[model samples]
Target: MATPNTAATPTFMVFATLRDDTDFAEFAALREDEQKQLEVLRSQGRIGAHYVSPARRATFVEVVAADEAEVAETLATLPFARFFDAEVYPTTPPDPAEIAHRARA
Candidate 1:
């Protein structure tokens, strides 16, 4: 049986950057395939918002997952996974009580 995961599950921001030596043609082809996969993941509620850097060299993708491992797994499915450096940052909602306390201070 699999061990239960008791840790907090959270959303994440995924940062991915193409390698400097990446082949443009190959990258374009892989990127097109990756986009199709992303659409499917989005429909499944695994992926959320997405953005591109102003220079269009890097991408930021939001993912809803159980942990960093899940985020990594999701990224590994991307066609460019082997050709890019990626990082995942977990996120949490701010406490409303804290916000109210700060407002009263």
Candidate 2:
């Protein structure tokens, strides 16, 4: 089960799948705007890594917010918001020390 987000646990992973009926032409038209908005979020530290798979029509974003609602709000700012069906999962970033230990093991 996913843990609830709190002040100390504000990171979230969002998986957004593109709707089947989404118009690709329209999405292409707004690509520039989407890129700009994503840049703004990154600059503000509201978003971290963003990965997209055009073949799978999916996007994964790392978000920093107070809760799921805030995460949703942040995503809604995207030009492609209407075209996505998103699932938000609260996350705790992996510990670097733990990763190093596991790697050495």
Q: Tell me, by TM-score, which candidate is best.
A: 2
> How well does candidate 1 match the true structure in TM-score terms?
0.74
Candidate 1: misplaced stretches above 4 Å? 1-9, 54-56, 94-105
lDDT of 1 by residue, 23-102 (tens): 98887777779889889777665676788884867889977677788888877777877877888888774256533533
Say which candidate scores most in lDDT.
2
All candidates' TM-scores?
0.74, 0.80
- Indicate the residue-level lDDT of 16 in model 2: 92
In candidate 1 the C-alpha lDDT for residue 90 amounts to 82
Residue 30 alpha-carbon offset, candidate 1, angstroms? 2.1
Clash tally for model 2: 0
Error of 1 at 51 (Å): 0.8
